[model samples]
Target: MEITRSRDFTAERAWGAKDIANMNGITTRLHWTDQPYRWHVNDGEEVFVVLDGQVEMRYRSPEGERSQLLEVGDIFFASVGTEHIACPIGEARVLVVEKEGSV
Candidate 1:
């Protein structure tokens, strides 16, 4: 077993991540970012969890667009083909689980 302290995580680039695990084709990662992620649709489902700080989770829907403020411990599920983007409110740590090599 391994222990990870999400809040202490850092990266040299925006949305940089530390590989945590890869099992059954799913990849678990710890990401550190102070900027926004590009808008894209994942090829598979995604489990995005905010571990520290806050994030502005934005998505596009048939209803146009929508967004939410994600705090620590908040989880956002993005199903396959869901278009979305993540913009950190300053510095934030996020744990992401998705298909291996998914964008």
Candidate 2:
């Protein structure tokens, strides 16, 4: 077995998300100003915690896009292999927790 102590990790960024990881999972911090971000389908699911502000999550489909607004302390999950996007309703920060997989 392996244990990763809290002090051993650092943050990294890419494609609008800041991330950290251990053997079991990936954690991300996403920040938004006024710009929206778009995401494509991938293999894993993502769970999000709204940490400091508000955001709008948009899920794309064949007919149209559906959206949900998340405020501070709100939690939501994205299904595995779905296309989606998000934007700040206000200056926002989100904590994303996900398993180790392609998504």
Candidate 3:
């Protein structure tokens, strides 16, 4: 078993992630980032959980472009083909679950 503290996490690069689990080709990662990610669509569904800090989640849909503020414990569900981007308000920790190599 392993234990990790979200608040104590840090990385050398923007959006660096630690591999937590890989089961049945689905991967779970713990990410630390202070920058915005590029907009892209996931090939499969995604479960994005904020472990610490806040973020502005922007997405493009058939209706139009929209954004939401996500705080700690917030979960953003990105369905397949949902174009989205994550802009962290500051240094934030996140847990992402999705099919391996979805990016």
Candidate 4:
């Protein structure tokens, strides 16, 4: 068995991640960031979970651009081809699950 403590995780750069596991074709990762990620669409569905701190999740909808504040324990789900970006309020840790090699 493996154990991980999100509080102890850090990265030298924003969006740096540690691979946690791969089951079937899906991948699970723990990420650390203090900066915003560029707007883009994932190749597949994405599940984002805030493990610590807060984040502002921005996305484009048919109506227009929109954003939501994601606090600790909050979860964000992005369907495939959904354009979105994640901006951290400060230093934050996030757990992400998606298809392997997805961007």
Please tell me which predicted candidate would have the highest TM-score against the true structure: 4
Candidate 2 local lDDT, 1-103, one digit each (tens):
4443322232343224544454455645443344566666656887877776678888877778888988878987878766887776745666677765544
Query: What root-mean-square deviation over C-alphas does model 3 reach?
Result: 0.6
- Runs with alpha carbons beyond 4 Å of true place in candidate 1: none
Per-model clash counts, in order, read 0, 0, 0, 0
**What TM-score quantifies how close candidate 3 is to the native fold?**
0.97
Model 2 clashing residue pairs (backbone): none
Q: What lDDT, from 0 to 1, does candidate 1 have? A: 0.96
Query: How many clashing pairs in candidate 3?
Result: 0
Candidate 3 minimal-lDDT segment of 10 residues: 1-10
- What lDDT score goes with residue 56 in model 4? 98
- Assess the local accuracy of residue 85 in candidate 1 as a C-alpha lDDT between 0 and 100: 99
- Tens-digit per-residue lDDT, 1-103, candidate 3: 9988878888999889999899999999999999999999999999999999999999999999999999999999999899999999988999999999998
How far does residue 36 in candidate 3 sit from its true spot (Å)? Answer: 0.2
Residue clash pairs of candidate 1: none
Q: Candidate 1 residues 1-103, lDDT tens each?
A: 9998888889999999999999989999999999999999999999999999999999998998999999999999999999999999999999999999999
* CA deviation > 4 Å runs, candidate 4: none
Span of ten consecutive residues with least summed lDDT in model 1: 1-10
lDDT of 4 by residue, 35-64 (tens): 999999999999999999999999999999
